[model samples]
Target: MRLRVALLTVLLCAATVNAQTWTEDGDAAALLPGQTTVGSGPLTAINGTLTSGTDADLYAIYIDDPQNFSARTCGGTSIDSCLYLFDENGFGVSMSEDGCGAQSWLTSQFVAAPGLYYLTMTAWDFDPLNAGGLEIWNDAPWGVERAPDGPGAPGPLAGWGGSAGGSGGYVIALTGATYAEYGPPPPTGACCFEDGQCQVRTATGCNSLGGNYLGDDTTCTPNPCPPPLAGACCFSTGGCLELTQPMCNANGGAYQGANVPCWPSPCVEQPPGGGWSDNFDSYPQGTVLYNVGGWTGWDDNPDAAGVVDGSNYRSAPHSIAVKGAGDAIHPFTGIQGGKWVIKAWQYIPSNLSATTYFIVNSYYQHGGPYFWTVELHFNPALGVVFDSLRDPNATSALPIVYDEWVEIRVEVDFDAGWLGTVWQYYGGQLLYTGNWIQGAVGQLAIGNIDLFAPHPETVFYDDLSLQPWEPPTPPGAARPLFAGVLYGGLPTRTTDLSGFPNTNWLSGFPFEVDGAAARPDGAVFISNGGFSGKLYLAPVEGPAIWLCNLQYPAEGLAYGRGRLFGFCNFASPLGIYEINPSNGSMTLAMSTGDRRFFALDYNPVDGLLYGYTEYGSPTGLYAINIDTMQMTFIAPPIPTANSAARAMACGYNKVYLVPVYGNEGYDMYVYDLAQGVGGVWVPMTHPFPESQSTGGAAFAPGHVPGDTNCDGAVTFDDIDPFVLALGGQAAFNAELPDCYWRNADCNLDGSVTFDDIDPFVALLGQ
Candidate 1:
């Protein structure tokens, strides 16, 4: 055993020594400019260690033009020099040309196992004027002294001549010196000279001495660099422009100095309507309508049958007035040509049950005529039932007006639908609400016509304004869960029920469910098997009945920051919809798709929606710019194939995902908004242990103070079992025969440890 140990120790030392003596060689004369030799031979490793033979020292040698030595000049101009070293690859890893006029050379030592490696070299020309004249050799010292000259032989210093009287003869040399290395001199305290003088070592002294020397320490008087020239800007004549002092032409042509005293001319703010004017040529006979305080109006030539000034008419609050009337509808002219929500205020005094009315019209050059008009039928007993109309026929008239200002509003979606809501305000109190809905319309008009009365009665109108209208907030149940029914195979009999916690399950196999939406008005919408992707309506206390078969039904299912919005995806494409709790109808409102959307549980702290796709990328994580509708790539795409996102949950500002893929369990990824686009994904290290695969995850709906088991109940039976598990008297495994595993999970974290026991003790029997 002693002999074997000694042999092993000897072998180890030899191996270490052999590893330190590796060498790599290359022809430096063949190196090309800008190309770095990273690794070449099989043994030449770029970023690793190598082992080699004993008694071998590694070194590298290369050739470069002496004139190209801006990096480090070794005194002269010519093609010259070679550098060699052990461990060259370790230190010379970053070799490159120092500068334009500097030779490319590098050397460094390696602290790894030695190895023999070969490097390929290419020829490089530092001197643009002379090329292809340099030659390089390996394993040779540069500028070494040779033996004294003999017959048919010249000494190393034979062709080199020293300065007069030998003052510069070979500066300094230790004769017969072995292993002499040439490098820059040691740093001294700004006093040492190459010629060995302590003082008087300026260019003059070195020249007089005929030997190179370092310059003396003369305090450097910094020469001030010239200041940059001021910039100038030019402007054309008759143009309203501002000019600064520095930019002004001091000689003062049209360009003068600034308003300050330093340059002395000020910039002038040009007056409006000064440099240009409109040239009018003709005037036709018609009422020239113009907007006054941003209101709506009309233009018409009541006399000239063909000269209607509709082309140039402007709409405003105080623009045009109706002088002569005969049930005529004229377009509101010069209304800035934009989609507007028109509103009006009028008054009526009598409670007559006659058909009295007022009409407002919109004329679109492309889609044609559209209108919103109000009708009123009043009686002493029934009071008045007000109604609004869109595209009212010439003969259709109900009842309206008693010489009072009645408030009315008209909303028109350019390509979608039109809505008009009329309200009666009596003494600052709204008395009635009347509304009209038109699937599609174009223009707007406002006027009153006599139906049964002898002539038209004048109704005062005021406070007319055109402003954009915001859609009403959607109303729906707080949370709706649609359960799926599972059918047994081979016989197709109902065996179980599946609650699709995530929405993506709807895309798969022929699973059926009595689909329902819990309504805010205490109603529910259910669907029979008749319509594909259709839903039925039923009151919470009533029977389920079929409603309408919706197109692209999945599009009706939209999720937004903690709220869900449902509407007929195609029929009323732009209408706002909500499940009415009172009747369970998917009621349509006058509002459309112009609201900001976000996913549920969006983090205000990080400004990121927890589970919604920021934008639609295949990558499961979407960072949506809600303001811009731009979705940015967040993390790498989720690995589940053929899966769709179903539900998202948030806790501690991290978003959790419930995707619909096959048996590939619910994988969770955290939203690290801090890790911007293409950032690393942080996987949840500790997943829910009891989840076979996560179907969906959510915080318990209702709070229970001591229901540690999270089974929706709290009782004395939960305490003793939890204590027994905490005392180790019973195992809390899921398969354990007793209920300790269930009762001891007091914290509802799927575990029965100190975490579960402590919470149970605090709220015991509560």
Candidate 2:
């Protein structure tokens, strides 16, 4: 019996040894395939083991075609696995989890070209890509040693809450790639020089030439070199442009050091239009607020000082709170003329039963003699809010919503003085519009704001700002034609529609946009199609604003009637919903029974909402009467086997549709409504890049050359508007508020000036 047992044990040991084609070294160094060479013209099965919970097995492979390569861990015993692929530069190329049940694989398109790469197979919770605050391969250049997030201190990657099981055998199946043989580096590899140039050179040659050597077998088809840094270039006319240092010097503009942006326009010596903004995020919580961070106590009294509170905040973490005898004061400078807007986000707790005042003073001295230009009171006990500056004693009809964040805005036309209007708004709704001063008030300059908290009920304030205000331009105004495309990784590209096929890519977004609508004011409203249902307003000249959520994926968006509307294909009573531009609140405008619209746009010329559908009943180009949810079919369905509909837009008496599939070149179809033929959709030439996933499309209004008066003609009546445009954009906007200034650019040189007189005259002759 003892001899039989000994024989069985020996047999089991031999079988275990035979199965392990590769074994762990129990260190950071990677392992190589034990059975087969990679890229041997066929798939190879490599066996490895995770000896410990922190154990990770990294295999070096050389791929001839990265696109065809596939790696997956199948039938691993007792192992919850994670897989990662990195290029020769150690940058992440692909990652996968759960490709095989409880194991990992790379099934998606790889993000690298043919090259030497690393394939890492780690235990469930181990992620080398997320090294704890260390300079890993993700952040460093080639040849730099990166800190590994592994079986040591600082532990495995954080935030991944997957399986914790570890220490088991793993089987890796690899194809379209080969095991890398170690030796001296390759004779020729891609090298990058300081001037952002790339060339193939030997390791020794690259070192002597002061170039960065990528690795053996590396190629430069995609150009691995980084581009040169760009900085602000200042012109004599106080115009700032961003360009590389060499380009700036060539253009004869003074460079403003490296990496400096042109935003906030550093060329201006003073605050542009004189404004101030403070979110109070920089101040420490519970700190005394006397003479700190441009904030002082009322009447310079230390006992009556406010404190930075963390208990309640709108913007997050911290906000200024005031109670009895805790008054906060913030002063302003260089704010005198024009229409100045003061805004603050206020939060009042539901438990409050006392009154508090938000005061704005025109003439304020430290000790005495304060002229309160505006005084707004919040009284949750009385269930009402009112403005003391209203000449006829204006009060709010709506009750104060406690425990909610509300925007308090006061628009003061200091230029109008006593006759100037004081417009107050709460929660984006106009509360009152009255005299700026009650009776013959003298001073016009805005001096300071006093947070008067005489009662014990605490009131919090955050995200304060004082800046010049401009009224919103009405819809359908002439401006640069722009379009927005949603891409992966939360970056949306805003492209100029006028430069289609060679479009100018403007800004990036922070979230994945599912639908977009371009405004004539050079702004775009974007929505997320995900279940989160978020919408955002991104202006060309200002910061993006979170408007509101629609509670459903908005498949398309359009701007018309001075309001934003979203099309929802999959919602209860699915159809279009009218969205308020100011607050993002929405209401169902109409319902489309049994019809699904994939994309939507509004034609200003016809005053109809244009809708498009790729498949299903009523599939074609149609016009929707938003008031009644009725659709008018315009054109029959077109071929869509090679592509799918992405977005739709209407302008220039035409309807445009963008179709895409698998990153192929961008193809568009346009239907001229003026034809009324309902013929096949005509293809238009455009230059959209290949492989980018498109989500939405929109059209910004463009000006007609020589139509300065915006009367839709090049007649003699446009002469005066053209002359006013020559004075400057501000002057033209003031006199011809409804006219597009760029219409005066008859020469199409991007400006209105004396040089355009000849072209203007030619248009007059025509």
Candidate 3:
């Protein structure tokens, strides 16, 4: 493989304007008095080339001013130039590799006593120190006396050898030096563009095209242009992207002010809302419906457009007709909570050739990472419509209804107690009812709805509606500060930090809870950590229902971005996984790689996923990339005698790690990510809640105390709401239905009462 190298040249401002050019004349001599001269005049540009791979160009230049000696190779063609500076006795003084983008430069190495010097350039991997029949680098720097013999350093001959077969031309720019010979300076060389593309062009032509001219003869083989700087660009919809400032600005994202990576992201949260209903009647007949009214084709392909047909209409004179590869999708955001019903009237003709799809994504990140919540395949040939993602084997027994308008209704309940559930019905008859298939169980959000046709199977859709339904919250199911599985056969428990050192357990769970996460509506999902890894929905009063089974035992569970993330061990390639909140199915979001993560959580404030990997080089907390699974070390490791994996959860700007097996019973550790990276996990200073070992920590959404209005902060504005909450739960719920009434318990005494009045006042003052 030919290594193409580029270089950077540094020229010191000189007084005398002497432009001396020395071209290689019949293989310049390797010793003293070879070809070029380095005097105290101006800059000397050396034009050299390697005729073949075995060629070596040695410029025997004389340096008058020893202190101001600088030799650099920049403009090159098909060459990875390696520059070496040697003393008069042929002892290597200094060598540079890729000093400036693939080129070499020697500026820091000063020549103590400048008499005669050999400035040699060669392709990479051709080591001068080893080719001299001796390990010169091992003898104290690259200082070994060796004289050049010819193009290929023959056996036992002290000269440049091992020419890794590279034929290229290069221009060496020298400053504070002069050469004896003079020739026409080469004008055309490699020009680099901003996109890191190189093209051979003249200095004037290159500058005209806004490209950096790498002198006269630089190769465009290997890209040497420095890459553009990128930083975290945060979006209002809780999305963080790493992009250049220009790109970020173009996309209307707030740049994080520097080249900051997305991990430990500097992004701050904004507001959120997304959902839409559309009827094709508004569009003109035969119009391409793709990219119209937020409805775009799959992957934004304009060719896969749905035509608004006026012939097949269910309620009006228009409906979107999809055929061939036509796939239409309408996206939604922040639709993960409560129960949602998606209704659309579809007409599939009897002449359908292949299958069609009605899909719903739980989480569809702007660019990708689509988690399928519902994928109902309608196979006209098979005369069946089935839920592919959830119950693929069980095709709905109901016969396919064709040639008529049929209402396709899918009811999805993400906040259905613990596990998100979905119900599909076609033409008023039940088709499928099961857990919503998604990455994680905690987040119950739907990203978008897709209508697709695989193979010219014409399908018509009209009058689509995606709306939310209010599901009754189970009694006694209120927000809790802490929820985890107690060790030593103790049931799962819920507690509040408001009472602090004397806080009592709010409720004892019905079953074994190893890992747990809470939905925004205060429903908690707990898991049993064993070989079976059974997961359940822990209701406030009723018995917990078994949801699904996990492949591996999970100690920590987290809820964010409408999904539940788990730290699953007891399996090879142990790492973080997305636990389907509806079915408990697991999808490997990211492998731990080399480290082992014990806990995981999602920070809403920064819109970043966090995990803890103990006992490794990067043994500490990390911000994980959900797409790439790359781990960025953020905080130091949690120091403990027993490094057992535990459950983790996030609240506001804080991350709480639970069931830390310390000298005392299990303790909780809290780390404030707002404190920035390198933050330490400090033991909770307050008194302990549950005295047993626990795992799978969880915090109810918006669980801050004294924030009766649930505005995320305790201020005087909350006084009215706090007074209402103190009056009665029913009255408070009627007024502030969106706010968590438990937040009025400012005293952390686990209840809103007269005792919370003073603490509320204190919080207001603060």
Candidate 4:
């Protein structure tokens, strides 16, 4: 059989006394998690001084019951009772006990210096081994009373009607609680009791059994409780209340009466109203109070008393006020101008010279276009001066005036220097220009002026304008001329071999053989046939051969008016080829070569082509009609052993020759085509003896008429040489051609004379 342990109910009582007493309630039954209810009540005393105490104590007065339980198991699974005490000094204490079934009494004490305190009790299973019930009561000097009184008390002993069938129940009561001086404790294990109070144990372990129990009584007194001082309020065991003026609490301690006295607190006092003045009455940064509502203003008003419209002004106590004079009397003898714009409307006067002139002028000391004034002025009649301190001095005069309502236009041309203009105007009309009564008018003043006409002047002004002048323009830009190189010596060769007789010409299978003639039209022509060649015109100084192809020549060659006549030799037929000078393109002019043609030349005089045959008793020079392909013997060729003239050149109204061979050595001869006669073959007067052999020659195109040497200039050097050569007094020598007799052939007509001097001069440098 399982042993059964019955629940036990114990009724233990504590005997410790405290100076103050408080009661509390434990937690309500069936409360949810995180929910709590607090018990509250007023503390009433019985035969004890509740007014004063340095400490407080708490007690738990409650009932407990434990139902049937097994012999080995105690009914300790319900909530336990706990008590806590808190003081106004931020101190707290706590005590706990199992229900009346276990340790029935719980108490906590704390030091609380003559002030309000609070106590609390809670019921919970704080320890896993304890589960019981609780009921709380106020343990004051009065007997223990149930919370909420009588049957309504919250506990198992309150209005109970049940059978005790092996279930435990106990009723705990608190009594004999009072405040008094603590007495010496009885010996340990001593029991004591009082009316309606059960036996309780003292702090010394002495139990109170059936006697007047003084264990709950402790020392409590009024203890000099006073009121709070200034800047503090009275907060008592009741609640907090504010301290006001006159009702001062000078004792600076706690008080128990209503409306505890206090003084007007500095903590709640309003800040003082402040103002400042520049006069020595108040230095800068110094302040004073007016005790009035907020208002602050700076006054600089003068005696004239001008009103500033649309401005609201007020003065604040302790705020700074800077004062200056507004208008002043002028010392000089000129018209007085008033202050245009009033900076401030109120002012205080300094103790200084009152009669001193406070003249107003339109010049501001501060650098700006706004208007200001001065105390001195200049007069066109009596010069400038200032007023005396006490009396109007003889030097006192009216100040100069300016138009304030208009744009004061001042024009300054830096280029014009002093000649620039300075003008003032009222509206659009000009008021003053070049008429300034000049003097130093020092201080700006705006106020009343006691003059011959005593009256105050008020003026308004703004927006003065200035115009800056510019300088003149400087000169312009410049340009240059276009120029190019006209003519010069070019290298050429007519041979087929390389590196022989100079590499002026390139060698190939098919070779073009022709003489290039430069035309006055700024072009050149080349022939491309063996003997029956094609003529191609090319641009002057352009590439002689472009891409190894003749630009002009699917056609044949030609020579006629300002052109070369092309004809075939014994190997090929002749066709007239007109060459385009710009790109070397060739066109067929005419073709006729059954009559064998050998050489060609152009008559410089008539601009006609001369052709020659290879075989004849005397090779004849014939003029060809380029239009008709007809020919006439213009001149007989040279008497030569060979049959044909190999080369010919025409210039100077004559034709020159080169023979295949002659005993006279590369002989040169000229024939006058006009005379149609054979002349003596004249050797050219060459400048270099090494170059005397007659290779080939042609007259330069566009030759200046008197520049014989082709140097483009005529001079005495050409004249003297022709005079000597015309006299025939010297021999024709190639080494000294300039002095040779052949040089007289200046016209190159196979003779020399003064008539040749002209053409000699024409070809002098050439």
Alpha-carbon RMSD to native, per candidate: 32.3, 27.1, 19.7, 55.9
The most accurate candidate by TM-score is 3
- For every model shown, what is its TM-score relative to the native structure? 0.20, 0.34, 0.42, 0.23
Where in model 2 is the C-alpha error above 4 Å?
1-481, 490-511, 540-543, 685-688, 702-766
Against the true structure, candidate 3 has what lDDT?
Answer: 0.63
Error of 3 at 528 (Å): 27
**Residue pairs of candidate 2 with colliding backbone atoms:** 38-177, 38-178, 38-179, 39-177, 39-178, 501-687, 663-691
Provide the lowest-lDDT 10-residue window in model 1.
166-175
Query: Which sections of candidate 4 miss by over 4 Å?
Result: 1-513, 521-524, 528-564, 570-575, 581-594, 616-618, 660-664, 677-697, 705-766
* RMSD over all Cα atoms, model 2: 27.1
lDDT of 4 by residue, 624-703 (tens): 66767666655555555543343455554565544434333433355666675444444432211122222222332331
Per-residue C-alpha lDDT of model 2 across residues 1-766, encoded as one tens digit per residue: 2343344344434432222222322222333331112222222555667667776666666665467777777665557667776666555566666666776667537545665766777776555533443312231122222333233223333222233458867778766554454232336789887546688876655774578999977988888989777777654223345556765665445689776755334554355365678777888889878978768788778877789989889888899999889789985533554688899998887877677888897645455445677788776767767886663254453468788889999998855632467888888888888666554332445668888888778889999988788532111112333334455432233344544544433322233457877654335677875766777655332123455666667888988756688888767788888887544566788887665666788776666898877665757888888876678888876555554666777765678777754246545677888877476777654323443555676775435788776544689888888888889988887765534567777786655679999999999999
| Model 3 Cα shift for residue 682 (angstroms) | 12
Candidate 1 TM-score to native: 0.20
Per-residue CA lDDT of model 1 for 1-766, tens digit only, reads 2343344344434432211211121111222221122211111121111111111112222212112211111231121221222112221221222212322233222112222211221112111111222212211221331121222121111111111110110101111111111222222222222322233333432343343334445322331222223222222111111223332332121333232110111222132112111111132324332221212122322321112222222222221222223222233222211233555454444633334344443222112222334433322233443332422332322244445545555443332322334343333444344343233321222221111121233223334454433432111111122222211110001101123222211101112222233322222334334224455443221223344554423222322332333433343454334443223355543233432111223333344433343233443465443444354445654544533443344332345444433235544444556656666544432122222222222221122334433333466755554555666533433322212233444565533467865677767644
Candidate lDDT values, in order: 0.29, 0.63, 0.63, 0.29
* Candidates sorted by TM-score, best first: 3, 2, 4, 1
